[model samples]
Target: MATKTKITIQDIAEKLNITASTVSRALNNNPRISEETRKAVLKAAKQLNYQPNNIAAALRNGKSHIIGVIVPTADRTFFASVVRGIEEIANKLNYKVIICQTYDSYEKEVQTIDALLSARVDGIIASIGKNTENFSHYKKVLASGLPLVLFDRTTDQLDVSQVGINDYLASYKIVEHLIKEGCTRIAHFTSPKKISIFRERLRGYTDALQDNGIPFDENLVISSNLQLEGGRQSMEKLFEAGELPDAIFSASDYGAMGAMQVLKERGVAIPDRVALAGFSNEPFTSFTDPPLTTVDQLSLTMGNITAELFFEQFKLKDKKFVPQRTVLMPEIIIRKSSLKKG
Candidate 1:
């Protein structure tokens, strides 16, 4: 279908019995326009469905006034909330946001960056894909002199602004909580250790076990993609060792949900025969039959800070601002899955 013609200032002016120039000036909030005329023009513009031409305005200012946001997926609550936070800040600053999902593919992440660059976005906020070992695509953003900010999943190889929770400390707290619950044999469902975030989490898990005087059993750990199916498969692999873990700490809520499904099928009662906990505090965690215990990584706040970092660069202009890394602490949410409740 063809697009409908957009209503313009002239269309609104015609409806308001005024000149197009007067309507334009009023819409732009020029001081020359009387308050009464401004109100009338705005009301008429709303009635006529007139939309401002941001592209024309951006051309005049030599800035797109649009921020490019890249994430693994919007299907997850954590990423969606981050987008929400970006939009909130973008709106307040009169900047628009365009989001791109890489779906956890390195190739697709490259494509998204190219597309955003083609669109001439003022800056970019990104959470890298799991498979992204190469950093050239991100380096290109710096080469172009565009401010780039990373969030959640980032790398040490590239020096860029980033915001995320302290995954190592968060994982340590998770394992410690399970130990306090009398769970000695604790299994872990984790992503590949190649990624810096996962590496920190895995490190925390092993350190926590060692600190608590529990032997670090590699057989009890399974690599997961942080997907629901991956969780189920990890559970099976953990049980194949001829020793069942009394508790499980999954790197993601989706993985924990998958473990729950498999356990329920095998007639295993949660927090009784086995306890469970997950990361990221996904929305569905609380809705499960037994609410899942999780660590809240402050996704929304991370996004807000990520966008603010981009604006901060604009303010500095000339002075060098060293690559900033903001790591927020994770908030542990206690629920039925991690606790033995009556």
Candidate 2:
């Protein structure tokens, strides 16, 4: 192993036959330094690949210039898009992002939050995990006077700024659409209703049926983990009972895809014998056999808005900035999967 030589501002000053203070001011582009001198210093610094010590700069500025994000899983398409949106806004503001995944575990979610706080992030944007019931950990973060914003899977119990789609209304609309397509026997595939998003969506599904003069059948609703295999197994059970629904409204695209595969194997023709609709217009939705008719949650916009909300709170502490809970309307993408009536 060879040792690498350390380069310093003094070296550049000595090489340029200029004082260290002049070199520093020029490198920083201080107004006192001439443009020509600043450009020369910048070019030299770039040629040397000089890297500033951000840690020292952060300490001096009393902020880390970094935003932390905690999500259930980074691999999911929705979360990945949200992260990209957050990164875009943060980059524009000369900030960086640190991301952590909870894997749907409440304990891991708390641990990630603690680690982010210890890292001294300027602010945090998070979507609570599936297993999260107690929000004391989040309350602790708020108590510490750090700016925090929740998105996607936020709780109404807590009075925090949030950005997400109107899950309840979106679900209601999708179910109503299925009803209008002449689907009398409709089933719902969703996770447990303990979480706010799932609860609201389930309510919407049931409400739409009741309001439209359709009897709400508990037997038609299947509670499953928001996973592909769960969807497959649940659909298999529904078939085994000899009461398969003519249509299904799934809470997630992954689950709907799984159900579609199982239904196709059993000779059930989509939009003919059975129809399917899902939430979160994931990329794979378009590539599916008939293209999924799903809800577009606008994950990227939600991420950008969440980041902007955090920054707003940080910048306008004394101006009575009201905590905003923004609920963006979801768009229903009508494709072959749910287009039953021409």
Candidate 3:
């Protein structure tokens, strides 16, 4: 069996009795080419099954027309929704997106950035991994002259475009709501303070307590990875103190769910014995026993805005650009987890 010869612009040109350059211009939709010639060239190219050399074209134009999107993990609904929002805009603009997950590992985040850079992507939009402490990898992106947009998880050390909710305000609102529910001695489950989101949430929690005349107790603040297991460990540690908190506010929904499981195992009544609230409003929050109260980070909107920011920067390439930070207002979703009925 003989393999078929790969069809090319030359073959299409030969079949249509037109110049190869004309065929190329037609395929590219160059305005200079007449519509009749462009249509005929396209029809012939399709009939011949011509495959254009995209790599060579990218080399000539100095653009891959591709963008990289980095997220900690896509398994969660929040990140997945954000990616959907990004793809909606990116696809319309004729740009392909490459999704990379770091799984909250600093080393993996660094390597992912390096890989994206090597791929020659036109730009990148990312949510910094929770474990990342160094901004050098992100700075390298700027030095290389590619646009970088950070969403949800961001750092101030690097001056680049960023889009996310006002985490401090969101935290304060939720904590205040818990307070209004008559929850005193509210405990907090948080992650490392190095990351801006966690840090801001912590600050909001502390400030809310002070404003409400509740004494700030260091013992009530538990620091951990904020994963499900971490939440369980943190709750167990609180139990060791021989005093139970009237309420629990977790920086992440996963952590809150973990704490909820531990409480249920101990026969503790939710919202009656101890109210609970969480952030990011992960989809499972609604389906949990006595649905949880959480903050809506507007993941899809954040993703759309992040992609738009990247495109804005891409268009202004080579221009002196000032970094733009977009902060969206977060909604506090009230549910049975935090509402105590008489």
Candidate 4:
């Protein structure tokens, strides 16, 4: 077995017959060092397989070159797309991403954020969990001088950079579309309004009905956990009430799919007896028995934008980086489920 030799800055300097200070400056891309010297130093470092100690480098630069990303769940397609986007941008900029899944638990979320802070990440991008009621953990991250960006799920209490679609407008548009297609009594299936995204969507649903002169009935609005079982049970409850809605707008595609399955089992003709619409534009939407009408939230785009926002702050340390909240417009996809049979 051959022993591997440790290569360091001093070794590179000694081989090149240059001072360590010059090699260090060249490696750091200091303006004082000429471009030629910088290139030569990098080439030599590469040849020697020199691996700079990231911890030491971070200590010197006052940045860890790592961004912490906290999301509700990693198993979901929407969140996976967002992670892909963040990874793409982070890789291009020579930054690393540390992902933590909160599993929709408030305690886990707090613990995860604390762990990330202890790890000395330069910035954070988070889509909070369902049960997150306190903003104190987030406030600590802000207080630590770390740049934070919230995406998809966020709180109004935190004044930070946000990248997401307009949930309210998306919901309103879907409901309006259903109404235009002759759906009078529309039922809304959603999770608890504790999260801003759900609340916004619920508001949009109510506002659209009011604008179109349809009376808002509390019974017509069904609250679920935005899960498959929840959707299944909610649909059953609505049907048992004997006032089946002319249409249904679900906040989650899975929920919509669940409801659709039950309706199909009961021999209800879609878009004739009831039309169905959902949010998130998940891939399953296209393959559903009668493809689903859904709102495209551009999950990947939101993720990419969040990474870009982090790099923007990374490059320009002293630049006035104002907290920006960007809301993408959702696009409605017309499909067989919501298309009326003439």
Candidate 5:
């Protein structure tokens, strides 16, 4: 059997009775090409089954026209929403996205970054992994002169553009809401990891308590991975240690749900016995028995803004670039779980 002949721009140009250079410019959507010519070129290329050589084009243009997006996990709604937002903007700019999941592992995060860099993506947008304490790998990205944008789980150690919700204020709003619902002894669930978001949430919890004239109790603060199982274990230990709180404000919705499960099993009434609130407003929060109160991180908006920021980096590439931080305000979703009063 004879090998199939590969189609090229020259073939499209020959069919259209135009120059191959004009065909190339039209295919690239170059502004210099007239709309009518571009349309004819595209129609002819499609009829001829022309396949674009992205690699060759990248080599000629010195850009891959691809962006790498790193996240802790895509299973969660928050990350998925953000990635969708990123894609919406990226596709409009004729750019493609390569998504990598770290699964909250530091080693995996580092390896993912290296892989993205090796792939020669134009830039990277990432949310730092939970266990990523070392900023060396992220710094390496900067050292290579690649644009980096961090979202949600970002650190100040790297002077890179970042986009995220105001975690501190979000936590504060939730805790303050619980206090307004007559919650006095509130327990906080957070990760022990040095992740900045968790730290900010913790600060918010503490400050809210102090500002509301409620004494902060170290014993009421439980540090863990903030996963469902961690929330269960933390609640169990708190009960075992006789540290029952009047209210619970977890940094993550999963943790709050875990505690809710245990509370229900133990015959403890929500809001009546223990007001519960959490962050991130996971979808399941509303389906729970009493419905959960949570903070909305504006995940979709964060994703769109992150992608926009990534594109903005290209504008400043030729100049002295200063990193910009975009912080989105959070919304508190009040529900039966934390609404004890009118």
Candidate 6:
């Protein structure tokens, strides 16, 4: 490869027939500098492809102008929308965003966090992995004195800013909706219990059943990964168990889709013989055969709020780590999938 030219302020200054300090002032848009000088320096800098070293600038002011974002998987529409929201604000603030996917692995989540720390990111926004039972990786972020905010999937054990929907209440409302549809036995297809969100949903499901005089049956609940295949397997097992639930409440839209496929394969009618509801109104949910009745977690708004929370913390300049929690109420989008009554 040919040697690439390294352009500096001095080179721009030489090209403009001005001092390096004058070039720096112009490039920084210093108020003392004339507008003509600023335009000329910008034109020269752009022509030379001069990239400012944020690392060197960070040494002076301790800001890398970079933000790290971690998500379970970008394949899901909800996470992609969340990332878009984060980038919307990040781009406006002139900060670069580095995205990392954990694939719901605890080890990968830790590795991603460490890598972001090594990159000297000014702040980090993450939704913890499903398998993340221990939050030591986040504790390290707290110890390092960096701005950290968790969204969607967060833990109360961690003293940090967070933004997420009320999963428990959302699940409760979904169960009640199913009950209103005349579903006596509501089967719950859930993710792992290690995560707080999943646990809360389960609590909501059982509580809703109990409050309505319906018994919480352990056999009706199946714990699975938040995947389509997992949902299918869970539905199959529920099938093999003999008695069918009048309605199914899935923790994820993907899982609900899989269950729907299984039920259809078995000649079971949706919202007729069996109704379906799911969490996180993913894009595919709306376009499903009968469309899915699901909860809108407001993922994009959650991301925006999380980013603003980080900015708030950064502005307050409080490094002591006070927990700031923001919870959003989830809305259920009633659709044909669960509208059994009408």
- Indicate which candidate wins on TM-score: 6
Alpha-carbon RMSD, each predicted model: 3.8, 3.2, 2.9, 4.2, 3.8, 2.5
Across 170-214, the per-residue lDDT of candidate 6 in tens digits comes to 999999999999999899998765788898899999999999999
Residue 293 displacement (Å), model 3: 0.5
Instruction: Give the per-residue lDDT digits (tens) of candidate 1, residues 1-342.
Output: 997588988788778888989988999899999999999988888887788886676656668889899988988889999899888888999989998999899899999999988777888999999988898999999888888888999888888888889999999999999999998999988887477888888888999999999999888888979899999998877667676789999988888999999989888899898999999998899999799999998988987888888789856646786889999988999899989644
Q: Write the per-residue lDDT of candidate 3 for residues 206-251, one digit (tens) a residue.
A: 9999999999999999999998999999999999998999999999
Taken over the whole model, the C-alpha lDDT of each candidate is 0.88, 0.88, 0.92, 0.89, 0.91, 0.90
lDDT measured at residue 70 in model 5 versus the true structure, 0 to 100: 95
For candidate 6, give the lDDT of residue 134: 91
TM-score per prediction, in order, is 0.85, 0.86, 0.88, 0.84, 0.86, 0.90
TM-score: model 6 vs. ground truth: 0.90
Candidate 2 wrong stretches, greater than 4 Å: 1-56, 318-320
**Which residue pairs of candidate 4 clash?**
none
Which 10-residue window in model 2 sums to the lowest lDDT? 52-61
Instruction: State the lDDT of candidate 4 residue by residue for 89-184, as single tens digits.
Output: 998888888889999999999999999887778889999899888889999988887888999998789988888899999999999999899988
Q: For model 5, give the 10-residue run with minimal summed lDDT.
A: 53-62
Q: How close to the true structure is residue 303 of candidate 6, measured as C-alpha lDDT?
A: 76
How many pairs of residues collide in each model?
A: 0, 0, 0, 0, 0, 0
Best by lDDT: 3
Q: After the best TM-score superposition of candidate 2, give how far the Cα of residue 303 lies from its true spot, in angstroms.
A: 2.0
* Candidate with the larger lDDT of 1 and 3: 3
| Pairs that collide, model 3 | none
lDDT of 2 by residue, 150-174 (tens): 9999998777899999999999999
